[model samples]
Target: MEPNLILTALFLISAAFTVVTAEYVRPQPRKDLQFPWDPKPSSQPQQVHISLAGDKHMRVTWVTGDRSAPSIVEYGTSSGKYSSVTQGESTSYSYLMYKSGLIHHTIIGPLEHGTVYFYRCGGQGPEFQLKTPAAQFPITFAVAGDLGQTGWTKSTLDHIDRCLYDVHLLPGDLSYADYVQSRWDTFGELVQPLASARPWMVTQGNHEKESIPFFKDGFESYNSRWKMPYEESGSSSNLYYSFEVAGAHIIMLGSYTDYDEDSDQYRWLKADLSKVDRHKTPWLLVLFHVPWYNSNKAHQGEGDSMMAAIEPLLYAASVDIMFAGHVHAYERSKRVNSGKSDTCGAVHITIGDGGNREGLAQRYIHPSPEWSVFREASFGHGELKIVNSTHAFWTWHRNDDDEPVRSDQFWMTSLVSSGCVAERRHELRKILISP
Candidate 1:
């Protein structure tokens, strides 16, 4: 064959190979689109959930069709003939396809801990009750993300409801609305059953950053609706915040935000971590949407920059466990630091298997890294039971069957001891004395 003819034949073969590979590598489309469930929101309150406002306060939130309806939460220790009424603000979000109805948030306070209070929102009908957490150690927290409205998601919720956790930590990716605004309402209803009973704390995720052409401010819908304790925690941005439950100091970070050293998040995190008194809250746990130590092939290295920017601070603070959910699978690391297993480092766990529209993350790179202790491709959620200041239990429940089965469970022990804190204090004292 002539040289020109041979070159043309090679080019044609390369082009065909490229086409085949591209087709094989393309991601399959999702089928879980939100059809209209109900055109009109009821006059009565709906989608009621709670958030911990302060040591003596709890915030109740609900939704209603009448935007002009009073955002009043009448509640007291006893049901009927309510003694206190708290007024709150209401807001709604509008999208091209559908606009959300009025969403109300009311903060109720000055109540005794470990006591149940009966409350009714939007004036009357279907009163709900919530018990404030006991001001002590051994509180349970339920965590998961990437949850959408599906049968699998319902199963996950069912399992979660059984756990009877005091608080729910959703590290972003709620609803998975993905520009279809109506899905947010549907998701709100789906989560109301569990969230209404427990304090559902959340952080911003990539999916919540619904950046359209005209409305590019991002997180307007999420920010306007799921108002967390950002203000109370001294965080300037709602995307991130810190709170305490029992003996644990929990820091919720934003993976989609600017996390450079000079960024506001970094500065705030430094301040928050510095102010942590390990003597009070012995276990320091951190949560976000993306994992810094994930071993799965789907979101591998996605959080590398984030890890580089904040890993040092976490290590210095001796964070006990870090939970994240965005990889659509379950992976638990063995106390990792800088992608390597260290005895004193924080245990990183990814529990994104919340049965979203996009299914489990099936593929994983082989010869698992030393840091990765357990990995599972399934729909599930995680429970963290702080048994004491030094010891805690971490369990991941897989929803393969109707009944809850522990895919992975282990005891996580904290390395933060009084001696360590005293030694650091002694070092500071020495520095001050030298100066």
Candidate 2:
């Protein structure tokens, strides 16, 4: 070795030795920044949430400001202590993830049928848990859409809190993240009261996708700030996924992507519907940010175009009902088959009344459409009550007041028979073919 080279090698080795020794002496933990509201260690858990993956299966998810440690969920009989533990990780292919954000999904299965469970998420020391679930059945869920952080939104959130539903489903368009991060923060604060208590399972909406940083990172603030069952059902992308709660099979779809007949989502959706066993999971519901049968003047006919692409599958597979938020209004359709009233057609509900600056959707976009059952231009959220195999009722809760006016009431008792066909009581599907 040359003398000069030997001298340089010695200096480089010394520098490396110093760095290693310093790091060993005082290694820094991966994260420390905490939400302004959190009182625990800045490194404590956050963005905790849960998703119902099936009748007897529940998925828990949460996030940390720091790179997450091993994710764990401790849960058990609600009101009872969390005695069981479960762990999960994202797949390599799916793990590269939607963007800089890292989302983790953990599925808790073999849950005793019809039982409630309390849970928590995060990592552990001698002990660790992240979220908690209410110890009750017939879980009441507060459903809202297109809610941003305006005065009216605060009013709506406050109103809902007085008599908030069991859980919350802000199907996209949250915080108006499409506008700016400040708005997202304000939006988060508005829902914190309700969200902190129960799971807040969300989907991506057009406005949420409008934020420069949010859209670029696939709603990272939303994705990382809240956990979802994005991977358990093979969605692998929060953009789309499925979960089951009680007698419901909820399929959440992504509308920002191409919904055309020739897209991957179409194929995946076809497969998803095929796999659901009507006997086991019963009620099938689909949710997206855009409507399929909407009749609002602000954004008329936009959703109808999407329906042109996916409605065939929805019809053939017996999708019970569909919910969407976009037009900034509330509308419900009786039932339609081939563009006219049919007893078995899927009921459509539009709940875009979450407090946005635009005010209540007060205009009629369609000129006496056939499927119209009820339409209201009001600022509020929705309450969905799903019971056993035979009954499910929905009510709209005006955010200005806690009163949930029975917006549109229907029965699913003979839904399978009468609801699937005007006259024919069809056999339960084993694998629903997209008829």
lDDT of 2 by residue, 1-435 (tens): 643344334432111111212111221111211235534443454444455554456665544434545566667765437777788763211111222223356777666644456666654422222233333335566778888766567656776776535557766777654423434444454564466455677788876553233224455555554556666677657678887665567788888877777776776777777677767666778889888776666666777767888876677666777888986777888767567776666778888877765455455654658798877666677777766565677777554343444545555542554546323223223223434
Query: In angstroms, what RMSD does candidate 2 have relative to the true structure?
Result: 14.8
Model 2 alpha-carbon miss at residue 367, Å: 4.7
Off by over 4 Å in 2: 1-41, 53-57, 66-70, 75-82, 85-140, 158-167, 182-189, 211-221, 400-414, 419-435
The top-ranked prediction according to lDDT is 1
How do the predictions measure up, each by TM-score?
0.88, 0.73
Per-residue lDDT over 244-358 for candidate 1, one digit per residue giving the tens place of the 0 to 100 score: 8788899999999999887999888877876788889998889999989877777778999999988877776778889899888899999878778877778898988887776
Local distance difference test, candidate 1:
0.80
TM-score, cand. 2 vs. native = 0.73
Tell me which residue pairs clash in candidate 2: 53-244, 119-131, 120-130, 120-131, 121-129, 121-130, 121-131, 140-166, 178-211, 344-419
lDDT of each: 0.80, 0.61
